[model samples]
Structures are given as C-alpha cells and as structure tokens.
Target chain A: MLWAYLHCYQLTLDTYTPLQQGGSADEPTVVYHENSNSVVQMNAAAKQHGIELGFGLAQTAALCPQAHIIKYDKDVEKQALLSLAHQLYPLASDIVINTEHSLAIRLDNLLQYYGGYDVLWNTLTHEINQQGIHYHYATAWGIEAARVLAKSQINQMLRERTAITKCLAHCKLSYTDLDSKALNALEKVGITSIGQLLTMPVHELGRRFTNDTIRYLTALRGETFPTRTLFRPSSTFKQHTVLPFEVENSQHLLPYMGKLLDTLSHYLRARNLTTSSLCFEIQLREAEQQVMPVSAATPFTCATAWLDLVSLKVERLVLQQPAIALTLLCEDFEPIEKDTNDLFSDRFTHLAQKQLIGRLKAKLGEQSTQLPALGNSHIFEKMTVYQAQGNGQSYGFDAAPTFLLDHPKPLSVASRVCFGPLRLQTGWWEENTQKQDYFIAQTPQGVRLLVFKDTESKWWVQGVYS
Target chain B: MKDSLSLFNNHPNIWRAREQPANTSRFALGIHTLDEALHGGIPSAGVVSIACTTGIGEVSLFQQVISQQRKHKLRVFINPPAHVCAPWLTTQGIDISQVLIITPDNDADALWAAEQCLKSAACHCVLLWSKTMAAKTARRLQVAATHNDALCLLFSLASKKPSSLPVSLELSLKAHEANLTVDILKQRQGWPVHNLSVPFSWTPDNHAIQWAIKNNKRKVHSLHSVS
Candidate 1:
C-alpha cells in the first residue's frame, strides 16, 4: 500500500496572484497569518532581501520595506486545495485532503492502469505544473510517513519498507504531528530525531509519554491506519472573486464577471449539465450588497450566450456604489436535453424563438412578453388574459370584437344600434355583480363598436371591431 | 470609361428597381377585389404599410390574411393600440398559442422589437402600430423582412397626403358602410388602384344573438304582465 502525499507550501501566495492587481514582477510579495501575525510565505525577491519565515510584520517591514503584504485566510487556502484536488481527480481516484495545504493519494491501485510509476508521476506533474503552483511531494509505505516526508521537503518515491524507515529516521520530531508539550518532554529526554524515538519499545515509551505521542509514533511506523474522508467534487458551482480595484461603473464589472462565467461554463460542461438562471451577488464598497439575477428562456451551458444576456442586463443596471467583490452562485442544474430535429427541416425555428424571447426579456423586463390566453369569464376584459409561455388554456368563443379597450369609455354621442341588446349578468358569488345590455353600435363615421348600457342607465363602449 | 461602368454596375450596394426578384411567394389577402387589384396577393415576405384609424375594421380586414399566414408558426404584435381579444382571434381560426404580444413603453423599443422578431425567422408575421416612423427605420425593417422571409405590417394613422417610404406595398384604408375602401398608394410592380371596395361580415347571423334578443323580449313581457 503506497501512499503519495502532496504539500502546497505556498498556497496562500499562489491563490493571491490571480486576485491581486497588476504589480511589477520584481516586487516582493509576502502572506502572513492574521491570527499569528507572522509571515507564512514569501516570494524569492523577499528572500533575497533577507526575509525569513515566522518573521513578525514589523520585522518583515524592517527587512524589505517595499514588500506587498496580504492576510492569509484558512478557508481560501482550503478551497484552493479542493480545486487542485478536483483537477487531479481523473488521474488519481483515492485522494484525501489531509490538511489545509496537503493531500494524500493511494496510488498503488492506479500503477497498473498507468503501466508504471514514471508515467503516472509525469502525468501528475504535468497537471500540477499547468496550475503554476509550487508543491512538494513524497511517497512512502504509510500516509503519515509520506506526509512527514513531504512536509520536510524530502521529494522522493519509496516502495520498500526499509527505504521508507531509513528516510523516516532522519526526519525531526518537529515535522511529526506531536504537540509542543510532547516535543519538549522528548527534548528533555534527549530524543530529538524520529530514529531515536522509534528505537525505544512501545511499552517503555508508554510509561514515559502520553497516549497521543505513542499513537503518533505507531502511525508513523505503519502500525495503525488513520481513517480519512476522500475528496469528492461539489455538485453546485460557486465562485467568489475579490476585485483588485474598485469598479465604479457597471460596465466595467463585465470583464471580471465574464471570467467567473467562463469558469462556471467549464464546470457545467464537465458535468454534462445545464442551468437556466444565475444569481450574481455584488459586494459594494459602502452600500448594501446587490443581487442581480439573469435567467435564460431555455437551459444553457455555453458561456458566450450567457455573457450576451448578462451584458444586456448590465447595460441597463444603475450602480449605487463602487463594487469591491463579486460572487456567482448557481445551485440548480438540469440534465442537458437532447434536441431532436427532422432531417428535412432547414431552419432551427424553435431555438431561434427561445433566443428571441430571452433577448427581449434581458433588455426589457421579464413580464414584457406574453402569450394570449382565454379565461372562463363573462366579462370581456376578464375573458382574455396574457401570460408567460406554455401555461395558458385556449377555449373557443363566439363572435366578438377584434380589440377590447382596457378601460371602457363613456358613450357621450348618439349612435345607431346595428345588432343585439344581449344581456350579460355575472359575478354574483363574489358579491360584485354586473348586469348590462350590450349592442353593436355604428357612429356617423361608419366605425362599428361594441357598446353596453348598465342598470344605472349609463352607456359605455367596450370594444371595436377593428 | 467602360471599366468604371462595369464596376458601378457590379457594386453590391446599388440596388436597381427593375432587378427586383419577380417570383417571390405571395399570400392571398382573402379579399376578391383586393386580390385582383394586387395581381396575385400581398408579398409573403416584405413590409406592407397601411394608413388607417382605429375602430375602422382595419384589423378585421387583415384577420383572414394573418390567420392564413400563421400556420404552425409564431405571430408577434408590438405595441397595438388596444388589448387584442383572444376570443375574437380564436373565432377567426387563429391559433392563440402561436400569438405573442409585446407592449413596449416607447416607440423606439417597439420598432426594435419588430425588427428583432422579423430577423429571427421564427415569426411568420409581425404587426406594429406606431404614429410615425423615419424613412431609415422603415428601410431597415424592409431589409430584415425580405432577407428572413417574414412579413411586417406597419399601421400608421391616415394623413392627408402620403409620405415616401421604401416599402413593398402601401395602402390607405377608409371605413365605408359594411365595407372597407382600400386605395393602393404604392406597389412594387403594379399600378396604384383607387377606391377598391372589400365587404366584411360585421354582424353575422348567429343563434347566440337571436337567443339573447328573444330572452330580452320575454323579460319585458313578464314585467308588463306583473304591472
């Protein structure tokens, strides 16, 4: 059972590069843990200026005054590690994110499929180099042993138990998972190296040290295996990007928003899914955060199409404050529907119609376009309804006027009646009853109208034949 | 001189009127007199401008043509004067499912929506009701309709004199008693016809109207007996 461990020592620095502003290549950059207030990672330029790890902020400033400082976030580092693991998932199936900056993979099962260890290593290195992250990797008989060797920057592959034990002997106690108390206790006893600690009997050491120390020694020696949760890709797509500079205009946010959409498109295509809507949460500099939702008439997985719709919506948006950050979230995903087309059909009319509706809705409001529907009502106004596509019923009616006025106008002039005194009385159950005698009237201009006289003896023109 | 003349003749942007395609498909207007006057019918794919007023049976005159053109295809209405009654459209044999209504707030959006719908090639016909339109905008709509094989009907309020616009057909409608008077203001390949009468059945004899009249008489007779 060979376990390969990878440690991303400069994870915070690597994750910060994509989000930082355009800075000079020679400028030194350093990331410090906010809680500890000590430098965790630094670029080569800072090292050249005599900066070291664990240096306090004041000390680093005194060393390299021109260095760029960034606060380290554990969650961001974890997310970056998870993304890296997802990239390596196809190459190695059994992967465990052992720590915030390290992962362990069981590679013995995959050696046969890759035909040898060198090809697998080449493939893994190629993928890691493509991401441009600095990493240290090592392999041993046990996961804990491999992790210790990787953390100590001993980059090698070992399959024999003797070789792994020989390498483990040189690793110091500080690289192990021992607490500071255990380290101090071992130091007092003159045991500084893992080689010295392993030579002692377990029962004898059990009397000298705590149970946790003994367990750590036993796991490092491949006596017991630690249970670890394997890494699995997330089902939903979400990306949060911190803008290097504040954007005042909504149009300027497109380039940043477009990058996030491209990532989402890649994720969706990898999973063979499509989404109908996306919600963008814009973090403003001073005002409250705004959530802009862009939806498509049909499910889509292409980035350019979504970008077109988003640009149209963003063009009409009014920005209240400068935006400092942006988060894109899409939780619901649907299986891509296979489109069936007839061989003789020349035009993609259905897709074109959906695209037209989506464009109109993006420019105008969502409720601007509707399909005509019929309702079950006696009132002319209530009988015709306009609703969204695919949700209305169609019922045939008798002869009626072509156009109905939204508000009936009062009949002030006299006109000759051509047809009926047809009476319509409805809405009794709701207590808003109506009774009217309707007629087809023609004015002197030869324009025919649908007129009605209510019980109050007032005449109203409801519609026109045209 | 000969080389330049050939170059001028071969230019793509220069469109000569006599070079217009002659065998374009036509949809019958369903009016005998108007069909005869048009030689075949309305051009299936181009701009047709009509100058008329509301409540003049102008919509009724085109009801037959719209229904016939909208078979298994979408029809869009951009900024109509009033709410189009679905029941009336259904009674005229129009598929209500294929009708789309877009009510834009301003005329600019209305014209834009019309052009998009025509260019999409998904719609069979587009109807737009606006007071006035610029000549450039009309030409754009005409080009879009011709290229995509879609029909655009521009309805404007009738003026005393006609304005020149690059449209395939232009007609002025007047409401006569039980008939619509159509005067062909312009046509692409035909002479202008004047005062062509097309009759419409405004008041059809139906059982629903007859039953209502009889019911009203019964109510009046019963009231008189009680008094």
Candidate 2:
C-alpha cells in the first residue's frame, strides 16, 4: 500500500510543558499549556529536587525557581497544521488531519503514482519544509494506523508493510486522545498495540471505553473516516465574448475591434500569461454557424499589440459590418516560470541594459528614440533615419536610397570648397532625378560634414562625424 | 589574423559545393545562414538595444536566441513590459520552469527586483523592456550583464543617449504597412553597420519549435532539442 500524508506536527516547548512560558535567552521558545498540573516542564524540574506535578505551586516554585509558564494555543497549532495540509493536498486524496500537528492520507492508492511510497513521503516532507513548518509526523495505509504513529519514531515510519503496521499499532495515542482520563484508560491494560486491541470485541470496548478511543481504534483497521473538502488553486485559462451586431459586410467589424482587444488583454494579464498568438472569431447572425479562426503573426500578451493586430486586420479589409460579434480566444499558452540562472553563461555581460532601456522608454516613448546611423554621407537627399524595434535593431533599408541626409539641412557655401564628385543618378529609371557633388569637408572649427549640391543648384550639408 | 579563412577563388566556371554544411553561426546562432547576418544572436554577455517602431520582427529575433538556449539547455529570463504584448515573445520550446518572467509594472521595485535577478547565476539570459531608462543608466546595466555572464536584451522606448552605454548590437526596427527593416547601428566584431530583413513567426505553444526538432529541421530552427 502507498503512503498518503496531509500534514506534519513538530514538537515544541508547549507540547512538553503545559505551563512553561518563554525559555531562557538564546534558547528556543518553550512549550506550555496554561495552568495544567502534568507539565512535561514541571516533571523535568521535579527530577532535580524530588518534587513533581502533584506538589503545590509553592513547592514546585521552590523546586525550580526559574520556571516560566504560558498558555497553549490550539488555534496556532491548527494554523500551522493547515499550512502543511495545503501542501500535501496535491499528493493525496484522503487526508486525515491529526491532533499532534500531523496528517495521514490513504497511501494504498499512491504507490504507483509516486514510483514508490518512500519517494512520495520524502517529496511531501521536503515540500512542507520549504514553508518553514517541520514535518515530524506521518502515516500510510490510511489514518487508522497513521493516527497512532505520529512522531512515534523514525524507525516506525521506515518499516515495510506489516512491520510498519505493527509499529503503528504499538505506539501510544497520547495525541489522538489528548486527555488524562483517556490516558488513564490506556495506561495499563499493558498493551497499546492495534493488533492486540483488535482481538477484543469492538462493541464491548465501545461500551466500556471512551468514544475517542473506540473511534481511534476503529479507524486504525482500514475503515472509512469523515473528512472535509479542500479547495485547489485555480488554473490559468481565459475566454471572451462577442458583440451582438450582425456582420453584413467588412465595414461593420471596426467598432468591435476596440472591445475585443480590451477583453483579450485583460484575461492575459490577470494570469500573467501573455498571448504570443490569438485566434480572432466572427459570427454572422443569419448564416449557418461557421467557425473561422485567424491567428496573429505572434502571440501577444500585451494590450497594445492586440490593438495593433486587430487594427491591422480591420485595415487590411474592413471586417464585415453588422456582424453579430467579434470575439478573441487564446487557445494556447506558455507557462511563466521563476528565474534561475545558468552557471556557465557568458562572462562578457552587459549590466543594467534592461534598466537603461526601460528608463529611456518610460521617458521618451518608443517612436522618438533613434539610433545614430553610422555614416558620413553629406547630402540632404542621401541621409537616412531609421525607426527602432525590440532591442535597438534598426529597420533594414527600404526603397529609399541606401544613404540619406542624416538630417535634411540648408546648403552651406563656404567659398566653393570642392566636394568630391560622388556621382548619384536617380534619372536612369525616373525622369528629372538629378545627380549631385558629394564631399567630406572639414571646416576650420573642426566641424567635419558630408556636403552635396542638388540639381536645383542648391547646396546642403548632409551629416556630421562626431 | 588568427582567423580561419575560406577564400573561394573566383573561378569563372567553378560550380563546386562544400561537402558538409559548415556551422556558420558566425555569432552565437552559429548557423552560418542567420549567423552571417546576426553575429551570434547579439553576443553573449552585453547590453543590446533592440528598438521596434512598427513592425521590424524584433520580438521574433529575440525568440530565436531563446530557442537556441533551450535547445542547448540554458535558462531564459524575460520581462515583457505591459504596453506591447503581441510582439512579446514566449516561444523557443524552452521548459516553462526554465523561463522566468518579471510581470510588467511601472514601479521601480519591479524593475529593481528584475535587476537583482540578472545579477544572479540562475539564468542564462535576461531580457527587459523599460519605458523610463536613461542613457548613462543603460551603460551601467550593460556592465552588470557582462559581470553575470547573462545577455541583457534591452528594448529602448526612448532615443536619447547618455554617451555611456556602449553596445555590441544596436538595432533599430522600422515597420511599414507590410515591409520590415532592421538596421544595425553598431556591431562588435564584423560589419559596424548593416540591415537585414528576416521573416519571423511564433506558435503559441512552441509547436513549430518542437516540430522543427522532431522533423530534424534543426539547422533552420533550434528550440526543442532534448538533452
């Protein structure tokens, strides 16, 4: 049978001492229950001076003057238990939460799922530890044996099959019963083993012993136990609605574009999953249902990209107007993961590149940030300006001349400084395209620029080298 | 020059072809095809400014690098700003757990946390888009990216210069109605400036990325190569 665990309980000073408050400085907090006589704390103190729990408070104080006491909190214990319970829910279906800060789920069903029971238990224990709650208790084969085995000993949990079952059967039920009378009842029939208890008539024991003992023992023999349902976290998924207009023709879909973008973008950001691609849908009110899906060149999880994409579709051919609705559905997704770095990536790193880009974008807006072109072309018609994209990648050349005026400028004539006769011909194919004189001239002030004269007999400084 | 040279003498009637396809990933892509154009996917550890105005396939290019890393078994950290999403990339067939993202937000805290992440040794690359970074600051980030062995792919929303941020690959994207151009302003090793238009697309679930592997079309696409 497989092992299932819902939570774990760790021992603390409160569990050991019903009345002890905080421990000495530099020591861990002591566990104590309020005003209880059988404090594990007092018992230890009594050993020092031959005094115990039955002695009066004055005697106990005389025996151990440094003892500090505190009240126990079931709520705190439960909160801690619940934190662990949440972690174990994914691995098991039937979780039996126990009183001493541990839980047991039916393990018979989990053996194959986990490759083996031991692996499952270790995995569960590891996950709980990450949350800062120690897991010292566990059980397998159902809560029956699991209840009695919480923190009994590591060897008990390590046993195989019947040995493990026998181990649980022998452990004390101080946690499950949690009261003196129950403790008194189990104190000396001399046998606390479930195997031994099973030999006795259950009904007779139910009549003679406390209900808690009867119930605890009954559940130990693979019986059904009552439990409450726990909620699982929601998975990331999204859907959008379409407007009611009928699509008679392409012009009618323009109005719905804005709303569609809003819906898709909202869903994506909410789950932190951006859509690199989406399928746009349109329905005709009168025609038989036709499911036409259109995907973007890229899956865009951003609103602006969604807007731009939809605008492109509409602009390409105005979607038919009077269309019943335009709906966007992202059929696929990429899960976002936490960052973990590679140990052997490049060492020639560019630090703060992201921060710099983010800052520039935040201040200047993307359209205005232009990369200075690398060239010294000195003619208004010969200089070029390129827009930017994803990383500072400049748009490759367009139909415009390979080189254009970096900035179109008024021609300067400084006593006919002759620019080299760089031949530019635009007239071979197109009429009236004039060739011009291009020169790299250095003014006396150290201002070096590429200058050119146009067919119109006008001169212009194209660009500078700085 | 300590360089391996292949000089194809101009034999007027020569029609010889190389026996095996050489790994022409001149830059990191190492695929001689795209490598000849993009030097090793913008270099390993440096601040690169990739600007896209309308439609230069900037995001697609980023995807290519991420795809390469995943294929070679490396981690990818992406921080896509809130405004521009479609063109934002998530492809490249990397394991979801290997790709970490800093959700887009306007506050400095989010970006700062992202910076601390880049300084770490847990990731192979860190890509970010900031609408507010300044010139000198961009240079400072580049320095950090170098120290950590992580490539910092920056999307500049602004065009100002702080004169401090030196970059290996400065690309400006120009997107027209249909045509796209990527002009390289600076290159660290080869051509200081050039422009190339490469077609790009993304499958939501990296289906193409994975298929490219199964179909053994890896030279053209490197995304889902399982180690």
Q: Alpha carbon lDDT of residue A145, candidate 1?
A: 90
- Which runs in model 2 stand beyond 4 Å of their true positions? A1-7, A10-100, A129-132, A138-141, A151-155, A158-170, A178-197, A206-216, A223-466, B1-227
**Sliding window of 10 residues with minimal summed lDDT for model 1 chain A:** A338-347
Model 1, span A1-466: residue lDDT tens: 8999999999878765655545654578898887898999988888999999999999999999989887787877887788788778878999999989999989889999999888888898898887678999899877889999998889887878888888889997889988999899989989989998778878878888888778888888787777778998888877877665688899988887887787788778878899989999999999899999999988788899899889989988887899988889999899886652344233367767887888888886766777888876668887787653354554555647778898999987778888777888888888899888998888877777899998889899998887
Kindly report which residue pairs in candidate 1 clash with one another.
none
TM-score of each: 0.77, 0.34
lDDT of prediction 1:
0.83
lDDT of 1 by residue, B111-199 (tens): 98999999988888999898879999999999999999999999999999778889999989888877788999998776789999888
**What does candidate 2's lDDT look like per residue over A1-466, in tens digits?**
4344433433333222321223533222223455564343333334555554445555556655655433345655664455345445666655656554656656667777888767866776676555555444555555545545555643235436666656666666554434677656655666454556646677767766877767766666555454534334234333333333245666455445554555455555555565545666665566544443434433455666556445544544543334554445566776443321234333112212232333333333333222223122322332322322335432221112212333547756453232354656555565656677665544433333456677787767654321
lDDT of 1 at A6: 92
